[model samples]
Target: MNRKNGITVCIIAIIAVVLIYAQSGISFGDPVYQDMDQYFLLNGQVQTGGNNICTDVVFDFRAFDTLGEATVLFTAVMGVIVIFRRLMKGEEYEAE
Candidate 1:
């Protein structure tokens, strides 16, 4: 077989192995760790003083994580704009 076909076969084999391993190791409806979930459910409202548990977790428990995600998203958008702006600089546009 050619190099490209060999590479494709290797990739497909890797993906199939990963899928089989994941399916065998993970249970669909049941989860292994419940201690953290129980703790959050019991004390999330008292600690964060938020009526919504989801918001409390996101804003209070994982504030830094959320901020980091937002910063990453903003940086990506700015990078895209800069790249496109540079590419479009040579193009001519009609007056609107």
Candidate 2:
């Protein structure tokens, strides 16, 4: 194969590997017993230290996790900006 074909194959292979890895997720089996109220109080009130379970889960117990997720979004936005700048080169727009 020619050099162009080789580079194309390499790029395709890299993309396939990335997609495969990105789609993989954790799978937890069903629990033997279910207790809704107890589970809610334990995970929500005790762990999160908040009066409201829902609020605790979202802001208190998962505050650090939310921050981490925001960082990932920020990183993705920066990556897109970098890629766009490279693709546009001298033709990039300038804001006043």
> What are the RMSDs of all candidates, in order?
4.8, 9.5
Error of 1 at 63 (Å): 0.5
Tens digits of per-residue lDDT for model 1 on 6-93?
9999999999999998899888878789888787889998998988988888988989999999999999997897677757768753
**Candidate 1, residue 40: lDDT:** 81
Query: Where is model 2 more than 4 Å wrong at Cα?
Result: 1-39, 42-55, 93-96
The total of clashing pairs for model 2 equals 0
Candidate closest to the true structure, highest TM-score: 1
Model 2: lDDT of residue 51: 82
Against the true structure, candidate 2 has what lDDT?
0.77
Instruction: Show model 1 residue runs off by greater than 4 Å.
Output: 1-3, 87-96
Candidate 1: global Cα-lDDT?
Answer: 0.87
